[model samples]
Target: MAGLPSAITVYEVGPRDGLQNEAEPVPTAVKAELVRRLLAAGLPVVEATSFVHPRWVPQLADAGELLDTLAGDLGDAARDLPVLVPNERGLDRALERGCRHVAVFGSATETFAQRNLNRSWDQQFAMFAPVVERALAAGADVRAYVSMCFGDPWEGDVDPDRVVETGQRLLAMGATQLSLGDTIGVGTAGQVGDLVRRFVAAGTPVDRLALHFHDTYGQALANVLAGLLAGVTTYDASAGGLGGCPYAESATGNLATEDLLWFCRGLGIDTGVDLDAVVAASAWLADARGRPSPSAVVRALTG
Candidate 1:
């Protein structure tokens, strides 16, 4: 009920993480335009690209050009343009193109890590060791992702200790923030609060921790409130609620940005974002993808 930010910083990941796992690739122009639309809503952080290899995630290979060519107001409003970097090579390409921030992910479940990264969790951390050092030395802000913190479909329930351990390791390796991802969307409010509680008890800074959830069963917003009460403010959300994990078949779209914004308004927490603009943007992206958005708020607004 306390320790919440007066104004929460919502990181719009629709351009990058939300669209990456789609069965089809979107044009670079469409992606670039989405970035612009997000800024019209005045979101401070927009993760616009993923620097992964083309062979692995061909959807995001245009990352370099997107960063170079994206024009309009987004150029000025986006506080952190974080890109996903799987390794040092990925980091190199991102920095070369004026990327100010980058993110590296490690799963708490070993099996999921092996499937997603083809490496153990520890090795994934090791792969990022030099990447973190290089990024920090280059004056880039680094964010570390601890995925499947609540539970993994493949590995079942994850230990809270392991999640905290990975969070601590990434922070120790110079990551400025940690995003705990519920990759399968199976986390409930109690579980979310417990994980946040344990992470804080483990000496993790509450402000530096973020909650990334999916709404497979429509629990994302409820879980967000639970996190807010637990003193976690930062969140990762996708416009129009478009996303899913290719590695995990049952996964669904991420927590919808509009849905979260609606909740923030009801809670009297300022998000400093324009809801109508976000709905317009989400509608545009949904049309571009040729699918119905997972967001109830966007659906109703655009209906």
Candidate 2:
């Protein structure tokens, strides 16, 4: 707590990354309610949805409709919600719907690039170039999610240098921020600290980088502490630990917002998020999903 930043940004991914892995598509109205609830709970940046083709991610097929529903209530504020766009078509759809904050998903390993993006490691950049450029042209902010940054399911341990290179390129391409993801949640605290320092040594600002860790190995919070020690100020979390990689079979739920909030509160770091409100939201969503939340904090608080 002494060395960490006094405040940090918690980017809420529950609506998009959290719901995308559901077995069935969530109703559009429900998804809109979730976004409103998260916003009301003081999550500064709640990602609304993804524009990927329904054939690939049918769970989020109602991307457009979801945005429309939010717009009706939130008006101009809806445009500030970040959404994932996989390509030019997806970007077009998001922009047309007045989404001002967009993100592109990239992979740190070649096997994942091939499987997830259907492009080789190098090829994926070309696919992302137009999307980033066009989004910037349309007066939008672009965030690049570099997944499998720590370890990959197929490729095994990923090189930290390679992750830094990918992140630097994304920033060079006009992406304002990079969220390095430990897709399988196999990274240790030492590895997380080293990676953040490595990126900083390579001239990537710590403020422009974010840490997105999964809880599979039960190291998500520890890894976040390491990132904080290395000066990262942004983190990605989902309400109720509600996300996983649809492409990688070994991946698990993301760091729960409630868990992160409890951690930050203990350290006296201001996240501007209401822990009780988020717990309530997650509890509501758990019923909608017809299951108990995987988050420890949510369970203990609501149990």
Candidate 3:
């Protein structure tokens, strides 16, 4: 606790990132309710959905409809909703729906870039440039997610320098913030510390960076602690630990929002989130999905 920030921001990704990979289609109304519950639970930033084509991620096909519902229902709370836009077309859809905050995803490795975006690293940046430019010009906040920042399933042990370079490019492309992702869940605490330090040294502002980790290797919280020590304040988490990269075979569920809240609570760090409420939401989501909640905290507390 000596060097960590007194408070941190948790960006909830359960409705979008969490449910996008589910094999079964979650009803559009269910997704709307999930976002509502997460907001009611005091999550400051909730990623609502993605504008990716339904042909690819059919689960989130109702992205525009969901946004419309939230706009009419959530009112001011809807201002915090951020959706993922994969390219110019996705950005166009989001803008047409009056989205104020959006995120574009890229990769640090060539394999994931080609697999997920159908482009190489340079090409991916080229693809994102216009999206970022158009979003910023439209007065929307743009967040960039750089995947495989720590390790890639195909290319193990990604270089920190490369990660920094990718993050810088994103920031330069009008991205208001960068979320560095450990896509394969192979990152360690030490690796996190080194990477954050390198980013800070290379002139990247700590406040503009976020960490997105998967709990596959059971190292999510440890790496989070490391990020905290390195002065990172924003983190991305999914309720009930519900998401994994569909393109990466070995990747697993994201760091559970309830689990992260529990850890932050124990550290006396303020996340402005209710742990019990998040657990209840996760439990509800699990029941709806016809599966057990993957969050350790949710399971233990509910049981």
Candidate 4:
């Protein structure tokens, strides 16, 4: 606690990242309810849904419908919910529904760019430039995501330089914040610290960066500790540890919000999220999904 920030931003990705990998369709109503519950639970930022093509991610096919539902119920607050948009088309759909906060997903490795985005590493930026330009032109706050920052299944041991270079381009393109993702959950605490420092040394502000880590190798929380020591103040987490990459088979669930909250509480850092409320919400979602949550904290609290 001596070196760590007194508070950090918990960017909840439950409704979007968490539910995007579900085998079954989560009702639009259910997704909307999850967003409301997370916001009510004091998560500062809850990503509502993705505007990616339904053909690709059928789980989030109801992106527009879900936003509309939340718009009707949450009013202006719905407009502030962040959504992931992969391209101009996705951004159009989101803008049509009044989404003022949007995120663009990118890759730090060429293999993942080609496989997941259907573009080469260089070509992916071309695809994202207009999307970021348009989003910023429309007065939307844009967050850029550079995935596979630590390791990639196809291309092993991604260099931290590649991640920093990718993030530099995104920031230069007007993205206010960049989130470096351990897409395969293979990053260790040392890797986390070095990467954040790399970005900083490259002239990127630590405050303008966030870490999105998967728990596949059970190292997500440890990496978070490294991040805190390195001066990052924003973290991306999913409720109940409910997401994995549909494109990357090796990828697993994200850092669970409950797990993160428990860790931060133990460190005496403020996340402003209610642990009891989050556990209850995740428990309710696990019941809806007809399975137990994968989060250790959720299991310990609910079991």
Candidate 5:
């Protein structure tokens, strides 16, 4: 009844997630270069850009052009790009740009979902419903993400049952895969395990579930391991562990892809990624940002 895999997939969100919260505006060339370097690092699925309002995320205003332009340039490497598109306009833009896979996000908390989408949970799905239908009809893969799945900045702890309900709603709306995010990175291993177990118990099927964690307290890797044990084979990561929620006051970086690769390789899990290239890319970004990488492996290697 499910299409789960024995191995995991590492979706690199660096181009979109890593650069979104930069204190200074990152040039479009730099963003494109980041995607190029990620492709070189052997990532099969990369979240390239977000097609939301420029006023909300000025960092990704070039989402459409990036898609339009990068399509040809990626060449053989072009097949792995996944863009974050929030609305019908974005889907149209992506379709015009020929994006094969698109990602849309909703949040698990009522308050945060409303704050982000300006729509309640039901309204959010109602909105994404058409986009999902169109993407599927166009033969594009759709990944549905739910932010603040573990916890939210405004809303404290969220109910597991509510999270399952939201996930089910997204799936019922035809979202092929679902990603659960730790928006503020406040989840522990026990909490992460419990949440993943709850979703699995609710018949959400582990294969369709993905984890997006922030290493705010250095626990994201631990959480990833827990998810893998729960039969969740997909996790989202950002290069150099960069990026945080602009709305979340004290949030840190998303879990670094380089570090996660290191962990997976240690456990004999095939990441299909190159650690050296990822480290080099991380180093370059860290130097550009003037911030030490949150990844332990990067810090150790650079030091």
Candidate 6:
């Protein structure tokens, strides 16, 4: 713990990234309540919803409605609700609904980019440039997600240099932060350290980068330790481990918020998140979804 930061920021993504892939449609109210509970659990940044076309992710079709309901409820917390915008149309919808923070997603590999966005790597940057510019012009904070940063389902072992280049471009395009994603959950602790080192060496500030990992390989916490050793503080996690890649069949949930909190707490790293509250929220969500939470911490605590 000597080298690790004493405090870190946990960006909760359960409502948006977690439930989007669920086969069952969670009601808009439930999704809104999930956001509320996550905020109540002391998560500083809770991703509220995505403005992507409903056809692609019908689960979050009520993005606008959810935002409208939480408009007055969020009060001072409204600024922490970051929504996902896949394109110009999504950005427009978000802005119309008074979204002040948004996230754009890109891929480190061309195969996943084409499959996920129907565009090549360079084309995806072109697509995000205007989105970032418009959001910045509207006085909104922008975060960029680079998927498949470690390994790709179609193209294994993505080049770290490519990931660094994408991160640099995203930062140059006005993204206030960059989230490096292990879309397929194939990353190792050593790989994470190496990736962070490469990004920092490429001129990316460590504070401007966050890590998003899936626990498919049971290495999420170990990778987090590596990131901590490398001085990366911000991380993205979902409650109850409630998500998986719809494209990569083997990819499991994002690193669970409860689990991550427990790990950080053990390491004396302050996340400012209530572990029990997050477990309770995940339990409520699990019951609503008619399944046990995939998170080990939730199961142990709730049981």
Q: What is the TM-score of each candidate against the true structure?
A: 0.96, 0.99, 0.98, 0.99, 0.93, 0.98
Whole-model Cα lDDT per candidate? 0.87, 0.95, 0.91, 0.94, 0.83, 0.91
- lDDT per residue (tens digit) for residues 1-303 in model 3: 699788999999989999888998798888888988898899999999999999889988999888888888988667568999999999999888778899999999888999999999889989999999999999999999999988888888898898999999999988999999998899999999999899899999999999999988999999999999999999999999999887897889999999999999999999999888889889988888889999999999999
Per-candidate count of clashing residue pairs (backbone under 3 Å) = 0, 0, 0, 0, 0, 0
- In terms of lDDT, the poorest run of 10 residues in model 1 is 71-80
Give the per-residue lDDT digits (tens) of candidate 6, residues 1-303. 589899999999989999989997799888888888988889999998899888888888898888888886877556558999999999999888778899998998999889889899999999999999999999999999999999987888899999999889999999999999998789999999999999988888899999999998899999999999999999999999988766667677999999999999999999888999999999998988889999999999988
Residues 1-303, model 5: lDDT tens digits:
133344568899988988888777787777777788888888888888888888988888888767655666776345458888889988887787677888898878878868878888778888899999999999898999988877777779888788889888889878889999988888888888898888878888878888999988888988987777777888999888888977676678999988888888878788789989999998987787787887888997788
lDDT of 4: 0.94
lDDT-superior candidate, 4 or 6: 4
lDDT by residue for model 4 (1-303), tens: 579999999999989999988889898878888888888899999999999999999999999888889989999889999999999999999899888999999999999999889999999999999999999999998999999999999989998998999999999999999999999999999999999988899999899999999999899999999999999999999999999999999899999999999999999999999999999999999998899999999999998
Q: Best candidate, lDDT-wise?
A: 2
Tell me the TM-score of model 2.
0.99
Candidate 3: where are CA atoms >4 Å away?
none
Best first by lDDT, ranked:
2, 4, 3, 6, 1, 5
Better of 3 and 5 by TM-score: 3
Weakest 10 consecutive residues, lDDT, candidate 2? 1-10
Locate the minimum summed-lDDT window of 10 residues in model 5.
Answer: 1-10
In the predicted model 5, the residue pairs found to clash are none
Give candidate 6 misplaced runs (Cα > 4 Å).
none
Clashing pairs in 1: none
